[model samples]
Target: MTKAAAVLDYRAQARRRLPPFLFEYLDGGSYAEVTLRRNVAVLEQLALRQRVLTDVSAIDLTTTLFGAAQSLPVMLAPIGLAGMNARRGEVQAIRAANAAGIPFCLSTVSVCPLAEVAAAATAPFWFQLYMIRDRGLVRALLDEARQLGCSALVFTVDMPVPGARYRDYRSGLAGASGLGGTLRRFGQAMTHPEWALDVGVRGRPHHLGNVAPALGDKTGLEDFLGWMRTNFDSSVTWRDLDFIRSHWQGPLIIKGILDPADAREAARTGADGIVVSNHGGRQLDGVPATADALPAIVDAVGDALTVLADGGVRSGLDVVKLMALGAKGVLLGRAWAYALAANGEAGVAHVLRLIEAEMRVAMALCGRTRIADIDRSMLVSTAFQRQDSL
Candidate 1:
């Protein structure tokens, strides 16, 4: 109502507010980005039929996942280095997600440690595990999440190798090469003065707190960078899920799944849920879009497991589209990240409100009074329908 009017409007504003390096990191996809574009394009193409005069007054947006009830059917996708976007960044995001009555997944690479974020968050949040090569360290981190009362451990399994984001290369922001890398990033920070004054000057020291203790007493950005390269376990396999299961005793979500076979495997491996994601189309350039892959994954596992989808979910209509295709819940990645970069906690809260409002309106237009009332009949495949017409 405040004239930002739509979720995409906030995205545009966020692009202007954030530095190019940070913005590109959040917005860009894998090489060529075909799947990235497809994710959104496919959702946009899904046309829903509106039914008139159908008692849409008592619209109910609430839904539950893994036994916990949500105010809406959306969740905040985990994004690393959120602290770089706002002061005590992850905490701000957690506060916003709590206010919205949704779960906030804490990334393994978060700038603030698990304990501090847990202390600030009023409700239980999910913890995302990266499966670091240091098995002992991974165990320690799991213990930390357990002690902090995390509700679930979301294991990200897609990035066996890091995706090549050309934007990072163009910006030269990896902090890889010596003092030159340092100076370049410094200039990037200087370009965004407000971000610098707020997140940079007043923010908590930007270290990966969970793993910092394992790296010993060396407590600067350089040491943190070195620790990251040494720790991330690129060789992780399905068997590694066993190691994770042994340590955590709550609902387990295996993220970054695309193939139906992998989805079934996730269920066999005891995952309570599987996220149909291509790492938001950031991991594999040629992988199928989450929307395209979701139905198959859901069909493969059926009622055996919970199905969640992420990547290119920009609107409430998109949420409805995924649900009709067979997703119980959807995760918002770059959308909310843009909101966080735009105005911290308040900006993210605004986005939650905006998306919730859109969902309510979209549901009413589709003749659905509640989220559960939406079904596959509301959607028609363009290809199948056109073939029938022919």
Candidate 2:
């Protein structure tokens, strides 16, 4: 099959494999999905110039970040409740990422525990931290991640409150909150027998694994969500980040910075890197795409910190566009989740292979022999009214 056909085939397979609810959770975003669609749409508007002649053979995609070298500029974005998409979803994705020679960031809300994921993956992966109200609990989790040899600490700054995901609401996932929430969730789980037998029947899904200890053996989903809602420190600030930085001496990456000023602040706050993101357009409905905001953030830091970009990154061409726009690397979120939902480890591997191939082809066509050579000059924004077209 052709490369584009392969991706389409994967999408078709993924839809058939995953239940409607699980699929929507991976595919949907905040209210109306306005920003989510806009995110990809805006990126698609930019054009890449195709060059006629260049010695494109010997292309090198190797790159460095936080003193570590990676085979590609793509990293898996931290995703929550990944197991719902597939059995042992976190580890499966990690294994695929490790094989592909890329970093995988485990979410604070992963179904698998930090130690479990760490134990399963061959390489050191980054751990994403969602600072909770309980300082002691936060400290303990960070300490655990550090002990597990996490390469970096990614502190997500947005999402003080959960965004109103219309899809989740429509799926009745939101209303499935109560003492029997676990049972209700299980009922929904019945719809996806594959996920049920793989992750549910074989393994239990509960609160954020790292923070579950604080909840004292609670197994109810409502209780878990309650604790999470009450505990997610809404007043988190740069001062709080400093507190984290003081405790963790390793590379500190501040995630969820879309504003240029915020990126400047991240650099000023002693962060080693900053992920330019809008939380995959899951947090807010009208935020600009990460690509549109990336150049400014890179310019603001004055090359002081590594700048990575996320949100609406679907293909290798998207990765190239991000790099040309000044992002040192790109993060994949829903794309990998789709793969996980479709075919587990093999599916994720397919996505990695697909994107890498696409990136290579895009690079060759744009007269950029190497990933490092992709630049802003390769693109042109098509002048059109996006909303009307959509």
Candidate 3:
């Protein structure tokens, strides 16, 4: 793990450690992955303005998110099937996030249930919800999150239906059935003996822990996929948000707001925050990159809501870039997922440390001493003006 020097290094290690199916599920985006590539490419194009002589001696990265203090302007984004990446992967990631003084958002379909993760964690974490067709199940899940003392509720609205990720089909990850598909998946798993021994063998609770009762008896990957196909409510609209608001009295964050109009609507819903995301480019292809979509969303609702962005945020400078564009903070998905898959909890901690270090260097170079001071001034006019105006 010490040899895993960077986030990309952890990604490489995860590729080696996990089976092709699980690795592709984590790494690949939907369809042609045009939006996926655009997310990172657009962020990379944004040049930072460096300042030579400025008093950046005491850099402060501390930020207050939804009234709670965070060591950095980052949180671990909710990722489904995190446990498949490593043994007790969600619990490990939550613990790592707690130790780092950041928030960890548990997915509705997380392998570890909210109570189990709450028991394992040192502090309260956030819970992410997916609107399913079953209202009873949704209410139960929200109650469970409240009972577990979750600090916030992140309602993900982008996934009316799962994206058509071609890699999942190619890698035999999309609940492949029958003799040939099963054999191919088995062969891929057999190739990664380490993952088989650790996650497959030792990590016994492989199914979705949160919705186990609703799913009842059907615990295999195929069953889970079948359940998702039928359960996700495509008819879910903004009216459904009133139901969520009526049930949960905590800080509500609307994730997957790619449009300024949607951002305004999210603000109107009384959401405390809105994550400017394209579901990490996994939901809608050919859409604007999250980086491209962020400035407009922020401009629409920055004053009314705590605007956050996620998608292709692989480095600390990327974090700073989103912040400069009026995002109060950022959420990390693949970076932490890759780290967790590579070296379990410690790998997550290492990734956080690296990100904090990178952020500090970037802040100093940009002549910003505090996280709040990092605004459009830190960005080159060519990038900031061009993108923000769009």
The candidate that achieves the highest TM-score relative to the unseen native structure:
3
Question: Native-vs-model 2 lDDT?
Answer: 0.81
Against the hidden reference, what TM-scores do the models get? Answer: 0.93, 0.93, 0.96
For model 3, residues 269-386, the per-residue Cα lDDT tens digits are 7889988899887988899988888878887775898998899888998999999988898999999999999999999999999899899999999899998798988888674547
Candidate 3 deviant stretches above 4 angstroms = 1-5, 178-180, 383-390
Q: For candidate 2, what is the TM-score?
A: 0.93
lDDT against the true structure, each candidate: 0.82, 0.81, 0.90
Using lDDT as the measure, the top candidate is 3
| Cα-based lDDT at residue 278, candidate 3 | 92
Return the lDDT, model 2, position 158.
Answer: 87
Clashing pairs in 1: none
Better of 1 and 3 by lDDT: 3
lDDT of 3 at 202: 98
Model 2 per-residue lDDT tens digits across residues 1-390: 434455557667766666555566777789877778877886777677788778888778889888889999989999987866777789899999999999999998888899889888888999999988888888888888899999999999888987878886666566566645446566777876776677666756645577778777775555666776788999988889778976798899989998989988888878999998888878888888777788888888868899888887777888898899898889988878877877888988988998888888888888787666777888764556344323
